[model samples]
Target: MSIVTGSLFALALAASPATPAPPKPATTTLAPGVTLLRGEFVPGRQPDGNTIVVDAPQGLIVFDTGRHAEHAQAVLDLAKARGKPIAAIVNSHWHLDHVGGNVKLRAAFPEAKVYATGAIDAALGGFLASYRRQLAQAIDMAASDPKKQDGYRAELALIDAGERLQPTERIAASGPRDIAGRRVELQVVAPAVTGGDLTLFDTVTRTLFAGDLVTLPAPLFDTACPARWSAALAALDASDFKRLVPGHGAPMPHEQLSQYRRAFDGLLACAASKRAAAECTAGWIADAGALIPDAEQAFARTLVDYYVGNVLRGDASRLEANCAAPNDLH
Candidate 1:
């Protein structure tokens, strides 16, 4: 419930059903032992980042757990069906959509150690703290309406569950790691998505988990440092990953990743130019082309416009603030 819980809750609640039942997120077996809990982004609501479950030698390793209850349930369901306990968790970043289900999953798998960057510690007292206040106000306003109050309260509950969201095991560097007997390469990038992002690369499958560095419906700039983000993409481009798993949308190929990088660079360049915000949005949609489906094009444009005006061009302050110090994840 702790989605992008600021004005989005108010916006989503105005139109969303009392208890919306989103369709089941698509789950695909990307490789011999890798399963994807694909994230869902409703046109009018907050989105859930994708989750990757690896059948590691030690046990099931869950990569980003999704936002809502059902999304998290999908992950748990996969674990149950596999007849294996969850032995570890690898979060992409600290965004609620990506890590909100940490508490739930941890409860289910009491011994599962979470592997992520140390960024969430600061977010507890910074960005998420500010958002907590927003949710509280929204909750107060909706107190007169039971349905609306329920939605806002649910989001607040996750924010208030502070320590539960922090990583149990901090990923402080970028390199090859043998987790639960599974040898996987880990990529840590900062001031890009959240304060830090923990991406996973499994040579066994030639798959790179790009986290928020690559997303659909356009690049979401909620906590991104545009310049650093470009460098992050460049790093991904430099890699020889055959299959790339993004934090959102479907898994893509190396060529698709290259296409995404070009569009990302062009979007940033366009935003930095003297062109109007509309021009930047249009260029993003056009540049993204096939990566974004026809149904998602409108939303993609909205996201581009939001990032351009608010993050890229709105103020020097946002850029400076978002350029948070990188975590000691070398």
Candidate 2:
């Protein structure tokens, strides 16, 4: 998941660049004052995480901007339409799809502060740096594919983007922090989904933004340690939030989150057992039953199969690559 082409969702967006244009990000009202700019997961374009905009007393607080320009623009558009200033930007993780719009948003709101974990610093030098080199080699080898070249270049541009992409404020530990005149809980669950991941809890709405920790259809394990990630999910389940917003998919009630946890735990268990990978995949597809809508069941199946074969049961250290050491995987 460190690389752009990491997951099936990533491949769904990156594998080919000649598909139909993706529709603009859709804006939805998750609650009274919380608005969600749902990131587009269209066939041919890079996917973006759902951006949440909160109406703070001072200005708007944006959580997790999308990967593409148009998606970020939708966030900007939402702010403009409301006639408010963006006071703060909260990034859930270091993923380009989540933080790519930092510069774009900061350009418009120079005073806005970006808050996130410090994981991106090391990631830039290691994971993302490796990704940059891979893109360059792929672009060179794709001389005959102009459209593919364009797609690569677009992602490359984000890599070389402005310093605004870096966070101005660090969320080092789980605590209540005052952001844009609103108090929210920011949890630093590292070595779970990435080197650093932030899950925001809005005390006002009693809603927890679980980031990619609870992504629907199938959980992404590209940059995750299965054991550590399972613990992180436990932490979320223990939190006193009524509703949860995942990085992808719709906001769900606590019961639905429990379902996701069940599926994720089951997937890990199956992967650890001696059963066939197909059984593991089938377990995931079945465990994630209602979470994977009929329209997305096919996609969920494909992703789960890949996870079983290449990730969950693949290499010993692969899951702990982002962790500090393998001794403390759990």
Candidate 3:
């Protein structure tokens, strides 16, 4: 398969498994009124995106629902514990891990209005189509083992029944929005993570809910526009928020965010020189230093290669390709 599809396939294989019972997400209170629900970082299972819950005076506001049913349940449990009804739900981007629990959250809080950028339609369409194809492949591969087959089938049923929820309140521009008596600044940074990325900055808590715009450990460049992503990161660097909540991983401080931005800038410069993918990958791995540990060096190299070959090159055909043979670039 092409580099983009292959990269996604690899990530899917690493994250998506039909575990009989998924573990609970770890929740951390970032501030007095803000809480972060972090997804488990296991190798195989329904991986979850981080969910942020904001307790507003009128009610509760949630950002980015986790991927699995259990993950969503964890967010619900937090809301129940806080004794506040969900007033609004905000989707940072359209990725499945970020938006997968939309249906469940909406079901629980029917009156909760959803707010997101208008870019979700295209993202949702692409994901559902790709996921269906991948699920079929997984089902075929599991045919030899009845237990595995049943697991795949169960996952397929959830996919078929899952509903992708669109934003009831579309965020067309960046500015201050008053939701449930809470003031939030919605910053639109598109073609960075996805075409519909919306970064929320809480005026009260000074917390920046940066979707996939600022990932820890390693950034996912699968659907990124290198230049635009870099520009988005630069903008985030200029923001006044004190605490940063990424789409995945734990909440970090400004210093850590700056560190990630520097690495990203260096990688972009390396790719811009039109160097060999391997050469660029090595340079990035070297520049990243301890940011990428020795154990994850191989994976980091593969990601760098994908960024250079697909993202910087502007060659997205790989994302739509259906090659029978794996690229094995990793």
Candidate of highest TM-score: 1
- Evaluate all candidate structures by whole-model CA lDDT and list the values in order: 0.82, 0.81, 0.73
Candidate 3 displacement at residue 44 in angstroms: 3.4
RMSD of 2: 2.9
The C-alpha TM-scores of every prediction are 0.94, 0.93, 0.83
Steric clash pairs (candidate 1)? 172-329
Give a tens-digit lDDT track for model 2, residues 273-313: 99999888888878878887788777677777877877777
Can you list the residue pairs that collide in candidate 3? Answer: none
lDDT order of candidates, top first: 1, 2, 3
> Candidate 3: what lDDT?
0.73
Q: Which stretches of candidate 2 lie over 4 Å from their true place?
A: 1-5, 8-14, 42-44, 325-330
C-alpha RMSD by candidate, in order: 2.8, 2.9, 6.0
lDDT (tens digit, per residue) of candidate 3 on 1-330: 323333544554555344455678887889999988886544344457889999997899999897778888998898899889988899987666787788888889899988987666654355555666777888798676665566556545545644446788888778999987899999886557666589999999899999888764467776665567788888998888898988866687887787778888887787777677787777777665665556667766666676677666556553233211212111
- What lDDT score is found at residue 138 in candidate 2? 73
